[model samples]
Target chain A: MKKYFLPSLKLTLVTIILCSICYPLLIALIAKLAPGRGDGEKVMVNGKVVGYANVGQRFSDDKYFWGRPSAVDYNSAGSGGSNKGPSNADYLKTVADRIDSFLVHNPQVKKEEIPAELVTASGSGLDPHISPKSARVQIKRIAAIRKLNEDQLVTLVQQYTEKPLLGLLGPEKINVLKLNIALDNLK
Target chain B: MNTEMIGIIATFLITLILAFPLGKYIAKVFKGERTVTDFLLPFERLIYRFCGIDPNKEMNWKQHIIALLSINMIWFVYALFVLLFQGNLPLNPDGNPNMTPDLAFNTDISFLVNCNLQHYSGETGATYLSQMIVITFLQFVTAATGIAAVVVLFRAFAGKTTEKLGNFFVYFTQTLTRILIPLAIVIATLLAFNGTPNSFAGKDSLVTVQGDSVQVSRGPAAAMIAIKHLGTNGGGWYGANSCHPLENPNYFTNMLEMFAQVVLPIALVFAMGFFIQRRKLAYVIFGVMTLGMLTFMIPNIISETAGNPAIANMHIADAAAMEGKEVRLGVTASAYWQVVTTIISTGSINSMHDSAMPMSGAMMLLGMMTNCFYGGVGVGILNYFVFLIIAVFISGLMVGRTPEFMGRKIEAREMKIASLIALLHPFIILAGTALSSYILVHFPDAGWAVKPSAWLNNPGSHGFSEMLYEYTSSAANNGSGFEGLSDNNIFWNVSTGFVLILGRYLPIIGPVAIAGLQASKKYIPEAGGTLKTDTATFGIMTYAVIMIVAALAFFPALTLGPLAEFFNLK
Candidate 1:
């Protein structure tokens, strides 16, 4: 024990310092080398800026698409989740309310067809993307309101689908605002 | 009762078999007793040649200390830079931008002190290029350091007036080369096999069930997931924790992760005992620790399986309220993981603990409070040894005999130091909880101003239980959270961060100093009546000491939280 005192203390202290300092610096350098846009480009139609596809916006109309549940009132400056767990009575009540609200707006839609994301908020309230299936499920109502054929809208949805990067990155998804703008331009 | 528990129990049994062989191999290598690990002899010679490190040359204690300190300081500075600039980093598929000044500072201290408390989510706020590099590197180094520390301490326990404290560089390299890296690869491979996502792309597109095109957020999730569990560092790549499905897809992966997180720390105890030639004592410590963890977990799992009666009363019968949990994980896995993670000081979670049944939540909190008993990696074993010494002494005094642990006389100073180390977290937790609650209720514009008496979400005895759980989590260096509390806010972020650092370091420094102090003293041979620590009698005393100390310190706060919540629920 007498022989090991200095070395153990010295070794333990040194190890903590190495971890706390050297590692983070190396990661920072690697991150600087990684590529991507700092912020996404704004979506616009007819010279009027609509919204950024990187952040979610409210879709109150019955004929439009829906996104995940949010804690923030769709305020990007204050994006958040309710942080409510599945067992919270409030969480259950809120989801039930959303079910009722969705039923009122899209009476043609069946109860089971309402996607889970529509009733539950994403971890981050700022999610700007929805499932392609979520969009397709609302296709009939959206196409009817915009006076567009179901097949044309399906084509439009395909146009909005962003595939996995290089064909093998992540699950494919569609940008919500872009799809909404395309709906506005439907003949 | 859940299949997930069955799967986890199986994984532990399998990993235990694997760990013994591996631990034996490691023990042999470190003991300087010749073994197959020396097969990497040529690589060692090559590394020594490449790095200009000479193994044949014996260095004094000071020289070894300098080398260790220099490498650590480098990591510290690296972590600081990353914390200051996490934005503009690559592979941030969600394009999370940057942490605020307060949050960045808080996170910096949190990791630097080894607190493992995460106040900010990685998915939303941008973590800069520098921050990612610094943070992950810090994680890798800290883990290596922990294993390295254990290696050095093991040599200390075995040495008889020997000047050698073991090779720092060799220990560090071996920790990374042999332990962490290989474990990570195997676990990562297993996770990938189980369908956990592993990718570098920023985004992907998927067709929804409803037929709309949607963009999915993507990044290097698999890499982070492996380390987060392996290191017992619970910081998540996605904010939803293991619930992100991609990070913890199914029960098989969840089981593997639980094993990966827990097995190392437990194995290290055996490794410690083996190195010191006190394998019997190690088994006793392991037995006591396992009993403590299981006591909390079995009941918590059963309560959760019972489902929420209130929901049943409403005729909702929501099927076990596996809301914050993965459907594949179900109640059993979530309950077991919650307990395992808390026991091991790994904060990673597959379910939102804040949403668990009150009794289950209380169990999770209790696990953290006992974290000082057997924490992460080296720290846990070190903590247990401290209590071992104290318990030996106390029982020795009761029997009117000398306390000798592993043939060394336990003296007054050693016992004092050990007691101080073991008691540090309990003090910090109780005080921190009271202080925070006071500030929340009394401070101007404090978040708790509108404290809803009845609608307080967690209600009755549980309200204070949430507070107690948070305090326990932070103070014990177990970062799993009670979801009912608003912890992401500034008050908690700041206060919890403060408590977390003290909670982690005080206990660490206390035991470390004791070990160092013990090392400098001459060993006294055991007499005929030495109070043996390996006996079952000693094991019960050690368990009682740990549990009683924790209960006494936390009883009032527990009353406020779980106790109150329980009464109200009734």
Candidate 2:
């Protein structure tokens, strides 16, 4: 037991230095060369930082396209989901409320047309993007409120939609923050 | 057919190709045979001399376990102290406050046992100092502890009528140096290159076009994430885990993280075969594990991609189970990652498990509950060893002979230990779940400051699943959560802490003790009547035992949770 102590201590010290200190420091240095310089990429509008291109933002106004509901209230510092299972009454009520509110705002769209992503709180409270279908669902509401031509807003949504990687990996998603910025930029 | 499918296939093929060489190298290092990394011999010797450890000394199983447990206990105390006082410590750029005592206890035990069941958000809950010292440091050492224990068992298997297994200290250090550290460095460098943050900065504030200010947290995340996956310790640097874009930047990094979590566990299977010179037996074990993994993975992927029927009823277009999943990973990768993480006990999530289709949720739960489908680093193999003993005992009994495994008798004492370890898994999980359920159901208004309603974000069948999943994950030593349970309180922390300790140590102790006892017995030659454990028939029997045990103990609980949820969705 005595013999085991020194070796264990020495090894732990060496490992702490190697794994916890030097290794992270080296990786931090390398991260400097990547996009966003190890900080997330900032979406810029009119020479000001709008938000991270990858992180979702809160947009409650009728004039702007809304992102997914955030469990953390779009607080990137504490990202997470509501973690509510679908069968839970509270979760179902929350979804129903979201659906009711959506129908009231966009009376043209039926209750069934409201995408799940629009009603459900995302796993990462800061989901930067929404499915293209979710983005399209909000087009009528935004165009009605902003007094923009429906075709123009539809084109704008299409312009901002990013395709799945390698044309086969994830779903087509529109970055909510980016799309909202584009919405503001629109004439 | 599609690029996503091609990418998944490519990932599996690459992992298989790499595991064989890695397995061979691991065997050589543990055997002290000459190969690469010999240049570090001086450094190894210096470490031994400085620490006053005699590398030549061989320990019996009892002494090996004593050494392993003592070191772990020291680490646990150290981690608990560091975590409790982290707010006052230096290098805390974020100034994250000290954890409550209950949370500190849970986090420390979780990491020490290689469970990595995080109750607190990483950005706000842990300081940089705590993340580095308590979390990342334990990621390396705890993984090494499991590897070292398994290597000792391998020595026991290889030796003929030997009392000595091997030096635990030597195996522990060598595993860290030769296997874990090098792999972690490579993966860490790659992750950083792919845009994962590795900084000491606090949260960055950004203003949106809508004039809203947001705080984006940054830290030394890449290095921790690399080992978190490679070491099969799935605690994430951020609360979002791999679901966070910076944590898993692209599809490439996502694939890499999945491969990193799986490769070592698979390699360890091959390493066992190489060590015991029982390649056929290793192949049989590997085949069973792969078969189990595929059965779970295929169904999960299909169910997730099929989209939720409930959501489809709402006329949601592009309904490919996109909730709680990143657009970059989509359904296939997310489902694949769920199975990989659960089966291997990596627990890092590319998608939120709570939002998964009900059947997919069941598959993840089953993976952890069974825990032998290529489990965490060294521990997965250890858990499988228990099942092997049960299979041997049952098979021998059926043939009207005393159970003989590798020329050693499976006596009453060995059976008692193995049975205890096997039964303990379901007992802890079920009892804990039952107790939590009773508290939530019978005492909804008990006024414990946290109401039963507050414990679950979603009520009914899914709520029941959240509680069951928590205990199952805890007892399996697989740290993934259903994500909705408010489990940071005293009840959760204390309960899961006990379950984590028992779940981790008992299985470990049972397997090594059995192997040690077997090693010390007289060598008996193989005869015509001896059970051929290496045969395909025995492999099928082992698989049957694993499923039967899991089904008998967990089927009812599963029915209440994921199974009930599945039919409800239908």
Candidate 3:
């Protein structure tokens, strides 16, 4: 017992120092060279911080492309999903409300045509990108509200759509925050 | 082929290729043989010296278990203390408050058992000090503890009627310094380079285009995320887990995280073969596990990709179940992750599981309940052995001969212990779920401080699943939740804490005890009529036994939760 105790205590201290202290410090030093410097990548617009490129932000206006619905109201402090199982009454109600609101905003689009991504709250509650179809579905509403050429707006959404990484992982997505920023910048 | 299919195939190929050599190396490490890591022996010797441990000293299974349990108990207390007083501790840059006693208890046991179930959100619940000292520290040691326990069993198998199984402290420390640490360092470095945060700073405030300012929490997340996956300790530094962009920066990192979680568990299977020189038996077990995994995985992928039928009926055109899933992962990768995480008991998620399609939820539950399908760290093999014993017993009975395994007779005592351990998993999960359901059903408005209504985000069958998944995850020591259960309360914390203890220790005790007893028994040579456990027929029989046990025990609760949800969608 004594033999095991003394060794166990010593090893615990060594591991704490190695894993809990030195290891993190070393990783932090490496992270200093990464994109965000271990802070999140901040999106800037005319010298003002306008959210993070990686995180999803809520965009409710018709003139801008909408992102996925957020479960935590896009609170970066508390990122999570609504965690509502599909059959959950509250979850069904929330999705129904989102669909109704989306239909009212995009009057040109039929109920069936609205992409599921637009109504469903994202896993992180901060999905920065919407599916390309979700982006395309909102184009007519954005074009009418912003008074831009429909073709040009369609081209803009295309320009913002990111292809799957190495064409073998994830899916095609359009960054709603970036697309909307570009919309505000348009002449 | 589509990118999703290509990605899935590539993941499997790469994992198999890497795990092969890793298994051989792990076998060498535990066997105390000459290897590439021999240069690090001086350092290992120094660890032994510092602890006043004689590396040459061997312990019986009793001493090994005692060493493993006592050290773990000490850690449990240490973690409990750190969690309770995290606000007062240093390195708390965010000034996160101390945890309530119940929350602390759950967190401690969760991590201690390698469950990593987070009742509280990471950023708010724990300080940086607690994350590093308690959570990350346990991630390393608990994983090492599991490997050590299995190494003892390996000794029992390899050596003929040996009284001593190896030195527990030696195996534990060496596993940390050699295998887990090296792998974690490389992965952590890659994660940091790929933009996971490794900072000491607090939340960064940012103004959105909508002109609303939001504060985003940042910390030394990369280091924690690395070990969390590598050790199969799945608690996330942030609440969102791998879905967080920083935790999983891009596609490459996603692949890396998935690989890390399964590599050790898979490699350990091969390690078993290499150590015992029974490569054929290992292959049979591996085949059974892979077949079981694919059977669950393929259906889940197809169901998720086919999109939700209910949503389809509503005339939604883009029907893939995108809710609670990252576009970066999509349906295929998310579904794949769901199976992999649950299968290995590495409960980290790349997406929200609660929002997954009903069938996917059922597959996840099945993975946890059966658990032996390439389980977590060393424990995976440990749980599988329980099934192996039952399979051997049944096969013996079928052939009208007494069963013997690895030269040891399989008798009443071994079978009783195996049966008890096997049955214990479903018993705890079902009983806990039933109790929680009764409380919710009978006392909707009863003042237990937290109302039953407050317990579930969804009502009815889906709600029942949320409760069931919680206890299942806890009892499996898997730690991934349905995420809809508001479980940071006294009832959940206390109940799951006990379940975690029972689930973790009993399985360990049962398996190790059986192996110990088997090792001590008289050796019997192979005869003409001796059943070849390495044969394909034995493998199929083992698979059948696992399925039968799981179906008989869990089918009813599963029917209520995910199955009902599945049919309802139709």
The prediction achieving the highest DockQ against the true structure is: 3
Stretches > 4 Å off in candidate 3: A1-3
What does the TM-score come to for chain B in model 2?
0.99
Candidate 3: lDDT over CA atoms?
0.88
What lDDT score is found at residue A138 in candidate 1?
79
Q: Which runs in model 2 stand beyond 4 Å of their true positions? A: A60-65, A103-114, A136-163, A179-187, B1-7
Q: lDDT scores for all predictions?
A: 0.62, 0.85, 0.88
Would you list the rank order by lDDT, best first?
3, 2, 1
When only the first chain is scored, the TM-scores of the models are 0.74, 0.95, 0.95
Better by DockQ, candidate 3 or 1? 3
Per-residue lDDT over A86-117 for candidate 1, one digit per residue giving the tens place of the 0 to 100 score: 34456667767876787777777777676555
Cα error, candidate 2, residue B530 (Å)? 2.2
TM-score of 3: 0.98
Alpha-carbon lDDT of model 2: 0.85
- Given candidate 1, what's the lDDT at residue A70? 59
Q: Candidate 3's residue-wise lDDT over B405-429, tens digit each?
A: 9888999999999999999999999
